[model samples]
Target: MEFLEAFFGVIGDLTWGWALIPFLVVIGVFFTVVSGFVQLQYFGRMFRVLSSKNQSGDPNAISARAALLLSVGGRVGGGNIAGVAVAISLGGPGAIFWMWAIALVGMATSLIECSLAQLFKRSEGDGTYRGGPARSIIHGLGADYRWLAIIYSVCLIASFAFGFNAFQGNTVAGAAEESLGISRIWTGILLTGVTGLIVFGGIQRIAKVADVIVPIMAVGYIAMSLVVIALNITEVPGLIYSIVTNAFGFEEVVGGGMGAALAQGLRRGLFSNEAGLGSAPNVAATADVRHPISQGITQSFSVFIDTMIICTCTAFIILLSDVYQPGAEGVDGIVLTQQSLASHLGGWTSYFLTGAILLFAFSSIIYNYYLGENALTFMTSSPLALQGLRIAVMALVFIGATAPSATSVFFFSDPMMGILAVVNLLALMMLFPTAKRILNDFRAQIKAGVDRPVLNPDQFPDLDLDRTAWTGKIRENG
Candidate 1:
């Protein structure tokens, strides 16, 4: 067991090493440029489409708003709060700056990836929407890449069932154990019950719950952050200055340092928003929006909210409290943030963080489960096989909650995430022309005030547009 742990630890460091941070930043910036800054052009349209019903004659899937909620629910959980705290602990206040930069660049990454997922999305019985890296891989890379799709599915499921879900559950359990004196066992069992109840109900049910919970939790958390920030308003200027100066390793930064600040910022920022990771796109693929760009734009905003708003809020709360020190001993993860909050807010913080952990951790499981389930659809056709997969996922959730260290689990997950991002990025790059064409076409129609917009995929036959783009369009032959 020790040997295996050491091995995975090395692998995790190898996969998540400093080098990958620059590479990810480059990729994000590159896509943003190629997309003609679609993040800005379609920003307003995204919110408009998300709010208004799709009147474009498409079969009803879940509304775009629900899709946005579900995507936020998936990405914005424990990572936003605890993860931000972890970043600050390791990377320092400057990490917040890196996170903001990544989110800005990641807006493009989010747009392109979600747009590709939108294009390849498949409709099963009852107008259900299903598409992700699997479909995009198969469609863009051809049937030959189906094997890669299977590999991706397996890795994704493994990461979720074993790595993501377990780590999330562990956070919840550990938080409860420390804060409320609730036994970790009870917390784990309770979490498993809550997760199982929602996950078993499938995506539609998950979407409904996210639609309600995500906004409420997000607003409440953000509101709390605002109050804290207001109380420490005097520290705001110095904090912001330190974050920006250290972010670029500027000479003006304290302690005569640049490299450490830059490294910490990039690493924490990437970990926080997970923009180039291709995880949230899976959820974005499920929304019933009019155009692919609509979902893409909404996803871009989601990235902003996750990192810029929520994660940054966590950063402020910690910095304002002044309880965090760069080399602080015996502090990490949720505990570090908990200490900062408690220093100013008192013992009640323990309960607040525990509740936040529950919300963030459980939501992560739902999103993780959905990603795995989608992956499994490509792995096998047998109903029995699928049922077994579900059971295995639940079992892993239990095991994961009690696992010794989430570090080992992340070693496996981080690599898979990198590979998945690369595969998905390749497809999105190839599909760029189609995405741009769709965007231009949609804009034209919207500007013309066409009550019923019809997007003919045949207009761009060279792209071999996938069925997901067709939505509810009925072919003449059919």
Candidate 2:
């Protein structure tokens, strides 16, 4: 375990220090500029597109709405809660400023990647669709990039399935133990059982459960946070000021400095919203949409919803209260969040937080499972391989639950995420032209005064696409 920690720590430092961080900021900025600031222009349009029906009318495939819910289920989990706490503890209030910055840029990044996913998506004739950075490489860039595709598939499975999923399990188990005196192993078993049930049911079923539960739990948690915010409304202005100034302030430099602030903020923001990180695009590809860019725009809204709203809510809950401190030794992660909220609203909120973590983590585990399963489909279509993946996911959930702490799980997972991001971001860079073309197509159709923009695969003769997926404008009221 010590060796594993050392290995991951070394790799994490190298990746964040030299590569992923710069790449993230650069590509995010590039896409945001290249897209003509699409994430902002169609802000209202994203919701309209989200609320609209699946015009493709493919019953077997997932809807744009379900895809949003599923992706949100994955994005708005322990990371938003526990992960935000860690960022504040390590980097202070300033980290929140950086988080907001990355998320804003990442909104454009998510739009491009997810739109590319939809544009290059292939149908299986069973209403199931497969696309991601990997599929984009295969069909969009041709077979020569299969090696990069394989690396992406492996990294996606490693990061989301085994690594991040384990952390979620560890968090849920810890929360259960902290709040209810439940044995971690018992919690592990329970998570495994529930995870197996939903993951084995497949993605659409995952959507069925997520649509109902994720919104309620998320809203409840956010509403509770709003109560805390309201209670401390007077302190809110000073807190926001601190967040911005400390982002590059001198005292902060003397303390932990801007580097730690930027690192943790970008890392956690990516984990929370998953915009440019390439995770959400897999879910986006499954949606049945009249225009691929509509799903892209809709998914972009999710990044804002996750980081700008939900994560900010968690940040405010800690910063507005008396609980958080800069560079606090050994007071980080989920415990800090629980303690802060407990202080604000009393002890019973611990139980409430525990319940919320279960909902968030459970939904995330299934979402993670679907992503890994999608990666498997990219590598192979064998049922036995997928079943093996299911069992492996269940086993990891148990193991992660029984683990001693979340830090170990994070150390192992964070580096894996860095690798995956590099691969996916490279694909995004290479496929930038394709994404831009798709975005232009959507913009042109909307300019033509069409109420709902639709893709004509015939128009994109230079690009390879599955024409069967886009027949015409979305069906009436669909």
Candidate 3:
């Protein structure tokens, strides 16, 4: 067991260490520049597109709002709460500054990758749209790179479906056990049943559930944080100053140096928002929109909500309370967060946090399943194979909840996610020219005074796309 832990530990460090971190940052920055800072240029358009009605009448398609919620379900999870506390514990308050930095650049990366997903999206026989990093690679990069697609699909399945579900289950079970005095076994059983019921209904069920739950939980948690910040309004200026100064090594409140602070911030930020990691594009491809860039802009807003709004709320709650002992032992992860909240609001808030975590974790479990299901469909269209995968995922969720420790799970999943990021980043870089062209085309239409940009596939004859997908546009001739 020790040997296994050590093996995964080394792999996690190497995969997420200096080499890959710089690569991710550079790609994010490169896309931001090449796309003419689309994140900034289209910031308002993101909200406009997200709130607009579905432009396609495809029954299997979802509204842009539904797609955004589904991606939000995946992006805003334990990472927003527990993960933020862990970052501050190791990196100090300054880490929040870097989190903001990565999120800004990552918006551009999200725009490019998600737009590509829409461009290469294929329709299943059932009318549902299917696309993501794997489909993007196969369609955008050509048949020769199918091997890379297969590799990405396999890693994505392992990371999100099996590994991430287990992690979420463990978190919920632990919170329940600690706060509610519930047995892990019972928690696991109940969670497994709930997960099975929703997942069996498929992506539409997941999307509907996310639409209702994500807003409540996110808003409720943020509202709580807002109250805390409101009460401590006087400390806001100093808190902001500390985050900035410590980020640049000007302050040494925490024991670790500036390098550790930067590394931890970037790692946790990427884990939370997952902008360049190629995960959200799976859901982004399912949106029914007039232009591919519409969904891309909508998803860029998701990154902001996840890292900036939700994650910042968590950071503020911790930083505002006195429970955040940067160099202290036994204060980390979810416990650190709960303690910080209780410090300000009283012990009853611990129960409130458990409920919040349950909602957050449950949404993430279903979102993770959809990602794996998409990968499975890409690999093979066999229903039996998918059923087998579903059963396996449910069983893993139960085991993860009842398991005593999640150390091994984190160690194993970290490297798998790293591989997914590397493969998807390479594909995005290769397909950037096509994505850039689509962006330019969308901009041209907007410049022509079109209220909602409509794509014309006839303009890009060389690209492989489903013609019918864009036929629903409200053109002047129609």
Candidate 4:
């Protein structure tokens, strides 16, 4: 076990620490430029698309709003609270600035990947749509490269379904144990039970729960941050200055300088928003929106909310309170955030944060499960296989809660996620022309006075899309 852990740790460090981070930033910038700054051009259209109603009466298909919340559930989680604190502690306050930069370019990456997912989406017999990096690879790239899709599916299942859930469970259990004096075993059991309940019911149940929980948790957390910032209004300008300066090697307080800031910020930012990781595309493809690009636009909004809004809230709470100690041992992850909040609000804020972390982590756990299930479906349709996977996931959640450390789990999972991201990014690059074409078509309709741009598949004769799924045309509403 030790040897395997160390081996995976080396792979993770090499993949993420050295290779993936730079590649992610470069691709993100490339997509941002090639997409004609879609994130900036269509920022308002994102919200408008979120408010648009479903174009089809497909019962299994989720509305665009529900899909947005589902993706938000997956995006906003432990990474927002614990992960942001980790970035700041390791990389200094400047890391937060890089996080913002990555997210800005990542918004364009998200738009491209999600639009491709929708473009290549396959319709199931049950009236649901299914698509993602795996599906897109198979359909868009051709059957000869189906093996690549299979590899992606397997890696996604391992990273999200099994590995990520364990990490989330560990964080939640550790937080509860520290704050409430609860036993890790009991916390694990409860988490396992609740996760099993939601995941067993599948995507619809997951979507329903996300819709209710995401808004409340996001608003409540942001509201708390607003209060904290208001209280420390005098320090706001200096704090912002430090974040910007340190990001560029100007701040002496940063330990490893700008390099550390860039690495940690990009790592945690990708973990939080998952913009180009291809995970959210699974949920984005499920939405029954009028135009594929509409869901893509909505997903871009999700990245903004995850990193820009929720992650910034965590950054402010820690930086404003003066509780963060850079280069200090044992002050990195969730502990830093909890202690900082307690310093400002009260001792009782620890318990409040534990509850918030519970919601945040559990939402992510189920969302991860859905991503894995989608991957499983791509690999094999065996009911027994899925059932076994569910049981295995629940068991891991229990084990993770009781486990002393999440180091090995994360070490293994991080590299797997790196692999998933690379594969998805490569596929997106290959399918760039198709995505750009769809974007142009959608824009043309908007220019023609169409309030809600409807997709007409007849315009794209070269594409092999499921025509029935895009048959319903939504006209402009006067």
Per TM-score, the best of the predicted structures is 3
| Model 1 lDDT tens row, 324-371 | 777454557677778788887787877887787778777778888888
TM-score of each: 0.90, 0.94, 0.95, 0.94
Sequence-dependent TM-score of model 1 = 0.90
| Best first by lDDT, ranked | 3, 4, 2, 1
Give the range of the ten consecutive residues with the poorest summed lDDT in model 1.
469-478
Error (Å) of candidate 3 at residue 324 is 1.2
Q: Which candidate do you rate higher for TM-score, 2 or 4?
A: 4
Per-residue CA lDDT of model 2 for 389-417, tens digit only, reads 99998988888899756436556577877
Poorest lDDT segment (10 consecutive residues) of candidate 2: 49-58
What digit string (tens of lDDT, one per residue) describes model 3 on residues 9-84? 7767776864677888899999998788999998987776444355346556677888898899899999999889
Local lDDT at 402 for model 3? 95
> Candidate 3, clashing residue pairs?
none
The residue-level lDDT of candidate 2 at 297 comes to 85
- Whose lDDT is greatest here? 3
lDDT (0 to 1) per candidate: 0.72, 0.84, 0.87, 0.85
Better of 1 and 2 by lDDT: 2
Write down the lDDT that model 3 would get.
0.87
